[model samples]
Every structure is written in structure tokens, then in C-alpha cells.
Target: MLNYKTLLFSLGIAVALFSCKNQETEKKTETKRPNIVFMMSDDHAYQAISAYNDKLINTPNIDRLAQEGALFNNASVTNSICAPSRAVILTGKHSHLNGKIDNLSKFDTTNVTFPQILQDAGYQTAMFGKLHFGNNPKGFDEFKILPGQGSYYNPRFITKDGDTVIDGYVTDIITDLTIHWLEKERDKEKPFLLMYLHKAPHRAWLPAERHYKEFTKKEFPLPETLFDDYTRIHPEDLEASSPDAASKKYNLDQPKSRKSTAAKTAEMNILTHMVLTNDNKLKDSTVKKLGIKERYLGDPTNRMSKEQKAAWDKVYDPINKEFEEKYPEMDDKDLMKWKYQRYMQDYLGTIASVDENVGRVLDYLDDNNLSENTIVVYTSDQGFYLGEHGWFDKRFMYEESFRTPLLIKWPNRIEAGITKEEMVQNLDFAQTFLDAAGVNAPDEMQGESLLPLLKGEKDAWDRDAVYYHYYEYPAEHAVKRHYGIATKEYKIMHFYYDVDEWELYDRKNDPQELHNVFYDPDYAEVREMMIKKLEETRKKYKDSEELDKQFIKVYNDK
Candidate 1:
């Protein structure tokens, strides 16, 4: 009986010790900070993303995030430009507050970014690929960034040691560098924040040889508003103002809308600006023979080596030869059709490389057993115009340029296949990240934490509107300075500086934004309410007319 009791006591002690060990493991798991993989591509249109719309191209890898995670339908940027958009994401503040309102302006180094905060909280931060503006980004223990609009092939990266050129396609090189850092340099004991940025599908789109061959042959459907002249003023459109008075004052025979002025003044028309030699890769001799003036003389061949040039010529020469034979006999409309095809081919080809690289990174996480404890985010700097309004660039408050694609996946934390309709901006990224890591966001950061929405707490999210402002006017593309408020139901904009115009649109009624109803008597109450809302939003964000004028003066001095 004594021997049996001793045996029982030994077993009980063993059970207690095992239970204590299990509890300690659970505590460690609970305390571990999730790793972050924030991926951003330059000028990647939401429409181009297959998850949002499969009409343009099929991006299986990027779409995988949306399938398994949360896809934000109303994700947008505070400013629809490159540097400013990135600044907003980093500082969790607007362009004005960050002091990077335009690409020309220098980034205010004093502002504390999310990475800096994360680094302070014992996180290992590393950034690779296109930082776009800054040579040395803050808070990152290691970074390899493109100087400025780095080349698509054999690009130079600015590292902590010094500048070095990597020999390969940029998209592939960036992915390789990121993976190398993860597999070799990463500390297994610490959580990490990794930023992977891409410069693909930006202006002067250059793709890898494999993608160039395939996408060039695949023709894409044109956007519905490809030929939009921006001049049509329907009878109902005129009813907003006194029709008789408007007709007499503005000449009804050729009615012009506000879009007409905005569109015509802007230089983004692809047909005129997208040169065949510079953009479409037609031979200079062929272009000369066709009596076409090439838009710019920036030939990618100048940067290519003998072998790289040979490879490029092997693919583009045949396509250019076919164009030379056909374009001579084609009319303006037919030429527009051809140019649109070429544009889609080169642009989408680069995106193909990006999609493939994204898959590689995701697979790295899955193979290494990091998916469950890592948060992967895929987004673009800003949305781009892909043949919409006959345009090809971004920098407007229009839907095509404003609404960026945002997808996030945090296994076991965020439910799969969730589609969020609430408006979220790049501005929310910093706070959202800090909240997820259990770190305190700086009080000066203007954006709200997106934790509630990311965790599928719809009732906890309460943003009714978003504010936007663009300051780079009298510059490239000539997009006028504008500020606006966008809600689920309406959008009100004031185009100031060179042009003083106020436009409002009922987002539900005019989904395409084909009409401006600011003066419509039928929408008088809505207009008043929206105006009040805009004022309140501006006040809340701390933007004012005085700042607008100050920025304009700063711009003028330049």
C-alpha cells in the first residue's frame, strides 16, 4: 500500500510539471508580435487587380490575398500621387503635415514614422525595393532602395553601405533581396516588419522577356470611356442651372461641362502624349517614315547592354514591324485602338512579373511556417488611369485614380474571404500596424486605427467620409490643385489655383461621375449637407484655405 501511494504521488508531480510547461508555452505564443510584410507597387490600378476586377488581367497571386483575407473595396489615398501617398502611409498624416505634398518637395525627416515606432518596440525592420524618395529611410535596420524611378533592368539600389547595381530585372531582384534578408539576416527570436515595394507598371513600362512575349500577343478590351470628349452636356445636366439662361450664356450648340475644362487642360491624353518610339517601342526610322513626332526621345535601348538589347529586339522588333505596316493606313480612331493595345501589353506585362514575385514571397512565408503569425498586406501607392477618360496617368480625385487596391491577410486573426466596404485610406496603415503590435501610436498621427475593421468588427468602425488634397499643379500632367471630400453617397471637390471650380456628384446616381450636380435645385439639401460635411472634415483634419494659399505660394516660388 505504501509503494502504490508513492507511485501515485510521482505521477501527480509529473502531471503538474507538464501542465506548467504547457502554460508557459501558451503565454509565449500570446506575447509574440506578428511579423508584417507590407508590399506596395507604383501606379498599380485597382481595376488591373483581378481580385477587384478580372476584366483587365488575371493576377492569381495578388488575388490569393483577397480570397484568403480581407479585401477593402473603398481603399483610397489622401493624395493621389506617388511620393505624397507614401508619405501619408509612413507618417499616418496628410501630405501637408508630412511636408511631402508633391514629389518635388523634400520629406520632413523629423516626423516619426510607424517603422521607427515599431523598431523602438523591439521589432526588426527591413525595407527593400523602391522607397521612391528617401535615400536612407528611418528606423530600418537594413534597406536596399531605388534611388529615384530606378530602371526596370539592372537597377541601382542605395544601401546603408553605399549604392550598388544589381544585375537582373528589378522586380525579380527586389524579391531575391527580400528573401535573402529573410532567410539569412533575420533574427529568429524577434518579430519583423518588412517592406517590399515595386516600381513596375509605372511610366515607361518595361517587362521581363518572358512576360513581354506573352502580354504583347494578348489583346485587352478597351475601357468604356476611352473616347470620352468631356464636352457633352445633356438636357437634364443643364437643368441644374437655368437651362434657358445657361444655353444663352454658354452657347447650347456646343455645350461644355466642367470635365471638359479639366480634361482638355490636362496633358494625360494617351493618344497625344504616349509616343510610339518612347512608349510603344517602334523603330525611330519607322516613326519618321510615318510622319509621327515621337513624344520624347527616352529610348530604353540606351540603357541596355548588347545582350539585353538583343533580347529586347528579339521580342519587340516583330511587334514593331507589324505596327509599321498597319499604322500608315489607319485613321485616328484605329490608331487610338492600336496604341491602347500596346499600352496594355507593356503595362500588364510588368504587373505579371510583380504578381509572380509576390507568389514567391508568400510561398516563402508558408514554407517557413510564418503565415499564421505574419500579416501580409498588398497595395499600390495610388491608383492609375488605364485608358479611362483617354488618360494614362494618375493625380486626380476621380475614381480610377483615387481608389487604390488594398488586401490584408492575418491567418486565424482575420477571417478569410471577407470583403470590407468601409472607406479606409493609406493614412490608416501606421495606426493599424501599431495597434496590431500592441504598441502605442503617436498622438499626432491623424489616422484612426483599422484594427476593428481588420478583425471583422464592422460595428466598431465609424468613419463616414475621407478627405483628399493635391498640391502639385503647374507641373507634369498639369493636374490643377484640388481638395475634396468623398463619402459613400457623394463627392464634393473644389479645384482651386489656376481654376476656381466647385463640383459635386451623387455617387449612387452618377456612378461614372458623368455629371456635376452642385447647382441642381433637386439636390439643394444634399448639397448644403455635403458642404457642411466637407467643412467639418477639413476642420477635423486641420487643413484650411490658409494652408492651401501657403502651398500655392511655395509652389510659385519654385
Candidate 2:
């Protein structure tokens, strides 16, 4: 019964309300999807970062992420090796499922990555720095990666345009490219996922010329297990001369009468096989006086420009001169100690440049008011040894190399100054990204989302265990193939490429993992429990001896 004028007035009111509500919803949806910047360094150990352990070096800039947001106390990777770890993070599955079991195996581009999912969800995706995979990655819209093990000075980057040698330190160059992409190349309207990887603190650790003298005066404390004799172990019996020998039949759980081959490997010992001038980043003439033959001491700084080499000489010449004067009269023990010191100085020095560039990224985010809606994650491909167990490389399930550093900052969602103690692995990162963007993770993904843990809701997360597998054997460093399950209190593994051996550790009693307590009578109940758990974990991840054979076959064929 109302008139036309009143009816038109009421309809206009409803239409205006509807339009305003729609605008508000659109604005919310726009702000909800956070920009993810995952920053990673190669072989960066949790022990070196001040956020976890500050004995070796102080990493203030990297610590900012943990302080301003949340630090993951138990973050780890499915595989301990490099390329396989990277592949696991990209796909939310184990290496067995992803087909990237080791560095030798090419990453199957057919596998689904988190960036690919983000791209489908309307994100502007790009990767800068070392992807370290061949056949050119497919997910990122733009990629400029280091060709193989990139140089520290005048590093060459492989891009769609071809390989371009950029004249600068690799860390600084990578950061410059990242900033350029953010300011000039990236689309601001859409959310972005940027993978900024670094080759710093990797093999043949090289620092910038500026930081050569940074850690020269600081004498780092050696690891408690630095002189570990490998006497206390549970090694499998050697192959017998006769095929019918009873001892040849192995017992995987043999606890006593064990021996380890870690100290004998010539790949990464600071005292033995580490090239003098190359690994230590010293002058050639100075190293020559130490009686190290020129053939043994390779050149790591051959790629440095004239200016770069001059700056390097400015710092190293005096140090090397001092070393040559003192090393001649020293005995084997003193010489070994000197080598350890040199290795620590150069290794920690290279990390300083990484810390400096991280500060640059943090400052850029703060200055541009981009920190609030963006999630910043800092981690490494895998942890490396800082002379632990008389070794200096990864590819073992030991605690030093098993646990990587993981720090995340998301201002809008994750509360500041939070520490998540729940066990989480790199594989969980993919599902977490998908959940953040409101996209559904595929069923094939094997990891659970860490969204709740990141939000400081630890009670909501029930995962208390993680599985680790390292398959690179008869390769670099010569670590035997092993897989294990590590919970908060226990760790048990099988080193089973040729010989079968089971090792267990009570993390509470021996945090350093110095003793293999697989046969200790006190830990009998614990070992039985952990063995069952390991079996469950292997079955859950669909990792069996049969699948191991397939992975090994593919790796060998490659």
C-alpha cells in the first residue's frame, strides 16, 4: 500500500548498504593474504646463530626475526642433505615421494611446489639467488640462480637471458637483486612469494674482503666432542672373508663393539684434508712456508678481481705472515688447533656478511611499511658442523647437522617474542603457506600445516615427533646412509647402506650425542619404545627397504 516515492527511497537505502558491505569484504580479502618472503642460507647451522647459540658468532639481524615474531626451537628437515632438503620444502612430501633423494638426483619439476600453488592462487611469485636445481625451475615467474656452487666474488648468475657474471660478493649481489625485484619488478597489487637463497657459509667458505678481519681476534670455544675418539659406538661387523661366516650375518641392533669412520674421512676435517690457502682464505706464499705443497693447497680466490684480491691481501697478508712464523715450531696437536682456529675465523667471517645483508632486508621492510602484512622466514638448507665430532660438513643425522635454524615473523598474525617448541620440519612450510592464502593443500602432501603453531597456539598442535633420512652415501664426506626418528627425549636410527647398525640416544642425559646407548640396560624400555615409533614413522612416510632400493636405483642411474 506504500507510494512509489517511499518504495524507491527504501530500495536506495538497501542498495547503498549492500555496496558498502561488498567494498569492506573485498578490502578484508585483499589484506588477508600475506606476502611470504622465505630467506634461506646454505648449510647455516642453528649453533652459529645467536638466537639459538651465540658461542661462535653473533647474528643480531637474523635474531630480529625470532625476537619480533616467533622462533622455532625444534625446526628440522626431512633429509639432512642439501638439494633433497630444498625439494622437500618445495613439495610437502618426503624425498621418497618427491623423487629428490640426494644432491645427485635432479629435482622432478613435475612435483607440486608451494610457489606453484601460490601462483595459481593469484600470487606474484619469484625466486632470487641459489635454487641449486637443474632443468630450470617452473614455479617462479622470475628466477636468477647461481650456476652450481657459486663463487663468493664476481659470482655468475644463471637467468633466462643466459649466465651473467655480476661483479660483487654473492651475498650482496643476491640482496641487491631481491630489492630491485621488490621495488621495480614485482606487482604491488597482488601478494608475492619470494625465495631469497644464499650460497654463503657453504663449502669452501668465503667471506667478503671487508669482513676478513672481523673474527680474527675472537677465539671460539671448541665443541665438547671435538676430540671424540669414536671409541664408544655400535658399528656393524665388517664383511667376512668367507661368505658362510656366522659373524657376516648382521644384527642391526648390536650396541657394543662399535667403530665409526667419521674421523677417518678425508673430505671435511679441519686438521687433515682442508686445503690450506683455499679453505682458509689465506695468501699462497704464506701457506707455502707451512710445508703444505702447492698441489695440495688449491686456489679458492682465483675468481676475485684485482681490486677484490688487493683488499683481501690487505687483511690476510699480515695474518698469514704471523701464521707462518708460529706454525713451523708447533707439534701435531698445536698445528691441528691452529687449523681449527683458521677454519672458524673464515667460516664465521662469511656469516657476518650474511648477517649484514639480512639487516638490509629488515630495514627495507620497516621503511616501506611492508612488515605488517608480510611473513618473513629465515632458515638454512641444512645444518653444518662447526668442527663437531672432528668433522666439518653435513650429511649425518647428528644433532648439529640434523636441526636447522628456523625463525619466522608475521606481525599481523603471530605474536611477538614467541618460541614454538613443537617439532616441525621444512615440509610443513608448504602447507602453512597454502593455509595462509586460504588455498587447499593437495592430498598428496605429507606434512601438517604449522599455521596454528605460528599463531602461538601450541596447544592446538599435537605433533611431537619428526622423521629424518639422509641418503647421500659413497659421495661427498662419505657419511653412511641413515634414517631415524627423533622426539623430544629420544633418537634412534639405522645406518644401513651396506652394514646394518642401530644407534640410540637419550637426549636428556647426553645432549651432545657422544654415546650410542642402543644396548644400555637402563634404556632398554626406551629403545623398545623408540624402535616401535621409528617403525610407525617409516610406515607413515611410506618409506620401506623396497622404496629405498628404487630411490637408490634412480640416484645411481643419474
lDDT of 1 by residue, 417-529 (tens): 99998989999999999998999999889998877878867487889999999999899999888999999999988788876666778888887777777666676677678
Q: How well is each residue in 1-558 modelled by candidate 2, as lDDT tens digits?
A: 989999999999999999999999989956678899999999998988999988888899999998998898888888988789989999999998998988887788889888888998999988888877873777788989998777888989988888899998999999999999989998989889999999988878878777876777668887777766665454332222122212233334343355554423436666766667777766776766566674444678889889888887777778788877887788876876777888888888889999999999889889988898899999999888888877787877778888889999988688888888788899898998899888999999999888887776747788767999888877877787888999988888787766567777878788888777666655666767887788888998888989878767766776
Alpha-carbon lDDT, every model: 0.88, 0.82
**Model 2 clashing residue pairs (backbone):** 235-258
List, in order, the clash count of every candidate structure: 0, 1
Instruction: Give the Cα error of residue 186 in candidate 1, in Å.
Output: 0.8
TM per candidate comes to: 0.95, 0.90
Question: Least lDDT summed over 10 consecutive residues: which range in candidate 2?
Answer: 238-247
Instruction: Indicate the residue-level lDDT of 129 in model 2.
Output: 84
Q: What is the lDDT of residue 405 in candidate 1?
A: 97
